[model samples]
Target: MFIRTESFSQYIRQYPVVSTLIALNVVIYLLSLLPFIGDPIRNFGVGSNYMIAQGEYWRLVTPMFLHAGIMHLLFNMFSLFIFGPELEKVAGKARFLTVYFLAGIFGDIATFFVYDSSYLHVGASGAIFGIFGAFGALVYYTKKMLPQLRQIILPIIVLSVVMTFIGPNINAAAHIAGLVVGFLIGLSIFHPKRIISWRKPKLKVVQKR
Candidate 1:
């Protein structure tokens, strides 16, 4: 009982990291909406092959927090809300950030190489997709949750992929890149027992007379 209780507490504690990520993205989105900021901010976002070729490497990282518009922002934030906290709980704060950005940046890298010179993209979806992939990994790694994951997350993933292909202006490469990177990270990083407890054998108290 005590172990379970402690596990729950640790899980709850991980939420603030995810919340901070959401807050940063929201704040950046709000900043992007300012009168003069829009144009300048777009420069920070992922762009066509030419833009990256011109030494705008920062675009790889910045696009993770950039959203095109309010609807885009809301949709991505909703995804973050759904996936971030749970992932943070499992991955812990540092690994969660690593998974998020590593996948997101790799998504940008993929877009850089795969798409046409005119293609441009922004939004948290790539990173969020990474989170989704992590969730999928978590589901698979956790034996008890396999049934629930198959019933829930699997369908959502498939639907999301279908929607991405059909959706206008979607960066399919970014989505695919993030998903792949995230899954690999999950495979390497996720370990259930560490989160639960690292129990050390209590020394047997031999009362030496």
Candidate 2:
């Protein structure tokens, strides 16, 4: 009999950093299920307008990493997995992480300001939108090379718009805010680097022997 090995590790190596982030988010969510930690988890991300208004400003960012249920977490993670690797490869790990967190914060802050005292919200859509923003920026910047990206992205944007109107308990403000912030940050990353002139080396021809 022949032995066969199976491992997704090799496939994941191309995006080690993104994998790490996904792992961290999953771990944190799992931890939130414990009886002792469950309530505290709500404080971190329940989207309670009251808590947010009461000066728990940190909640805006925290909520992005925390989800309300298994389905919620899975959906967000699925989207992240689908889109994050490409964006991370383009933006680089550090910048990609920055954009994710900033977009999440933007979403949270927008929710905090827009929703009333009774409503509470939580999910990773904000960060996902940020990734979408970066994707749009990438398509725009590389229009010469990848004009097709715009066409692909346009349908997704339209679907998201329709979802905002039809989906119940959706936080439309946060989504818009995250998209704007992500786009701005994405655009900023493309600014031309300062040029540095290099001294030319002189070459001399040797006399034929």
At residue 179, what lDDT does model 1 achieve? 88
Weakest 10 consecutive residues of candidate 1 by summed lDDT: 1-10
**How well does candidate 1 score on lDDT at residue 22?**
80
Candidate 2 per-residue lDDT over residues 1-209, each given as its tens digit:
01113246853787776677778778878988989887787666666779877887777777777777898889888778777887777677888988888998888888877878887888878888888887767666777777677777767766876787699877898788788788888887644341111124568989998
All predictions: root-mean-square deviation over Cα?
A: 5.3, 7.1
| Residue 64 accuracy (lDDT) in model 1 | 84
Show where candidate 2 strays beyond 4 Å: 1-7, 191-209
* Model 1: residue 71 alpha-carbon error in angstroms: 0.7
Clashing pairs in 2: 47-120, 47-121
Per-candidate TM-scores read: 0.82, 0.82
Instruction: Write down the lDDT of every candidate, Cα atoms only.
Output: 0.78, 0.76
Candidate 1 residue lDDT tens string, 1-209: 00223354564465777777788889988887788886787776745577788887887788888888889989998778766776776577888999999989898999999987777888878898898787777767774856766567777778888898999989999998898888888877765665455345668988989
Displacement of residue 92 (Cα, Å) in model 1 is 0.6
